[model samples]
Target: MSPSARRRQEAGGKTRPGSPRHFLRLDDLGSGEVETLLERAVALKAYRRTGVDHANLIRRVLGMIFEKPSTRTRVSFEAGIYQLGGHGMFLSPDDLQLGRGEPIGDTAEVVSRMVDGVMIRTFGHHRVEAFAAASYVPVINGLTDSYHPCQVLTDLFTWYEQRGSISGRTVAWIGDGNNMAHSWIKAAVLLGFELRLACPEGFEPDPAILEGGASHATVMRDPRAAAQGADIVTTDVWASMGQEAESDDRERAFGAYQVDSDLMAAAKPDALFMHCLPAHRGEEVTAEVLDGPQSVVWEEAENRMHAQKALMEMLLA
Candidate 1:
């Protein structure tokens, strides 16, 4: 077992036997700790491919609380739990007292007593922090307005599987610079990969996150500049779920940032194309590029299950 695995097994009190847990932010972990999780994920994926029964987390329960609607996040985590010999509880907003004016702290305190771990996909990063603060059990950030760490973890895992490593590679992100972009920035910082982000003037990622990642990344105005010599070119929708009113303006402003064939061609010949899905085909990415041979969107999606399974096992070992 790895050092992290050993440490998890030995940690006392709140961790309990087979119940290690985590929160939603990448900054919550040191670089070495992140590597430990990734290594475990790779091992788990390999074991599954070979049909090995490594269900170390059997009979555990992961309470999945979602304040927002989802497709991949819900299915991936639920299926991941079962694959690891555990079961998952999918709780929608209306299903919990949280939707009826109960405090997040109260909800957290109650859930911790009931579940081995909790994964919350919600609107604010602060809500996740509140849940973590109140709960004795582990809490995983499924997604938040500020970051989507799991998605980026899976994306990096997929990249690792395909290219072996990301230490010196350049990753170019082209789009609205939302939560996914923020998480990617965090990944670049922790993994020491060169990152370039291109977004419209006003629609950039959080300044704090950008500044924090600046020591390791290069933020730019031009998509082509970011894509130049990149090993991977990525994008997401121009307007996110709650930003519907800005859709028209965003499309106009982001016209120069589309990840079409021309932009992909500027990257390395073998550069992979990526998008956190629910893609806006013609708005942020052209159908040709998203459906192209180099696109790893589907593989990236699949890795979510593997990476999340590794996460649950690590937190609930």
Candidate 2:
């Protein structure tokens, strides 16, 4: 295994042949595995449309713990699990005793016993790691400050559904070096793609992750330069969740990085525009571009359900 894969497997936790696997980061799965999952996602999508009875996860239960509010993640996982003949139990801070200072390991141990798998959307990456360490069942990182693996996994499936292959393609990311960027960096390293990130001077992606994928990823200041000759151009909000306090400062810093018509012009003519939505029309991306022909944000959002179903099945298998 590669050094990055080895590190991810270690971080994801070791399991015996018949035990569960954890998806703490994108590198937790190898390149071939990622591709296979994407293919499965496509099959799942088709099966959903055909009204096929592919309830592979019958009688299973998924415990979803959310410290952060969500639109897509919550709905997708809950509905997806139900469609797969499983139950999704939503646990919020108000619902769980963890708000009253319950230990995460204790919560993990207790929860994993009842649920077939657990997914957590929290502030810190270490919280998910701690839970995975204590749990007997599979653990998935729904969203973390360090990496939003599922979002990138869904994004990859969206790209794959459209283009059939992403290897050797150019993916331009224009925004903060947040969790999405980190996951994209990991994806680039694993999938042999070129990733160009154009962020303001101080908003680059995590250095260690960037360095690990240095051969396939590049950081730059000019958005157009990064988008130049790109096949996929994507960006996120200027300020992510919990960073609302720095809204004004972030607005000032990222003003020039918006993915507008002019910016989209820099990429190839047939290039696709993508955003993990709840998008701001006049901010990070313009209304015309987001609602325009090249934009696939809506399809990308729906793919979240299909992609995650494939992931959950893999973990349970």
Candidate 3:
């Protein structure tokens, strides 16, 4: 086995034999597996664009459970599954018996029997963990309070599509140190990409994340420092969906973290700007930067479908 694969096996969790399954976090995947997923995503995207039907994942069933409401997450997964000749069953919190007090274990076990895989977008990271624990089928963490592994995977694929490589490339993150920041750190560790994060002092990325295996990716107080010489500059909202109560406070705290022209100038001359939308204009990112020539936000959004299609194929095929 490759060193990365061996590391995954020794990590002490359920994994598919000869196939990496249950993508709960980027940290669980090795560089080789990430590359494989990315290569497959590229081919799938090309096929989709050319109107070639490549339904390698025919008849597979994916159960999507969403405790949190989303636009991109819902649309991309549903569309990707349909395009791959698979079916996706959407289960909102109210639609599931768990919402009416059924045990998570029972819900997981029941769903496992019916679905080829499960994708969950929810609040607590532990909910996804619990689902994975009881599931006989593959469980994918669509999003959680701590990480958004699927989105990060798509982000990396977008970068790879544009730059052709990830190793040694610098990616600067400017904004709230939330789930995206956490997943990006994990990606840096797993893919050997150099990541730099800039956030307000109190809002800096989870200390445990930076101090963990992702120490190679630096965290800084200065936004300029993070963006300096970076190949890609990325940012998310100052206040995420659940934190709407702290909107004013977040705006104050994240005042200096916007990815405007000033920040972009600190990066490489031709650096790409990325935002995991829906972006707040004049907040985490400026409208000018988001719509500018250097921005790849639209492509990044489009790649989410392709990247997730590859993930489904790998886990379900």
Best candidate, lDDT-wise?
2
Q: lDDT of each prediction vs. the true structure?
A: 0.85, 0.92, 0.86
Task: Please give the range of 10 consecutive residues that has the lowest summed lDDT in model 1.
Answer: 4-13
Give the candidate order by descending lDDT: 2, 3, 1
> How do the predictions measure up, each by TM-score?
0.92, 0.94, 0.93
Off by over 4 Å in 3: 1-20
Task: Tell me the lDDT of model 3 at 27.
Answer: 73
State how far residue 190 of model 1 sits from its true place (Å). 1.0
Q: Write the per-residue lDDT of candidate 2 for residues 237-317, one digit (tens) a residue.
A: 999999999999999999999999999999999999999988999999999999999999999999999999999999975
Off by over 4 Å in 2: 1-19
lDDT of 3 by residue, 249-276 (tens): 9888988888899989999998999888
lDDT by residue (tens digit), candidate 1, 34-150: 777778888888888999998888988999999988899999999899989999999987999998999998788677777788999999899998888667678999999999999
Provide the global lDDT of candidate 2 against the true structure: 0.92
Between candidates 2 and 3, the one scoring higher on lDDT is 2
Query: Candidate 1 — which residues are off by over 4 angstroms?
Result: 1-21
10 residues in a row with least lDDT, candidate 3 = 11-20
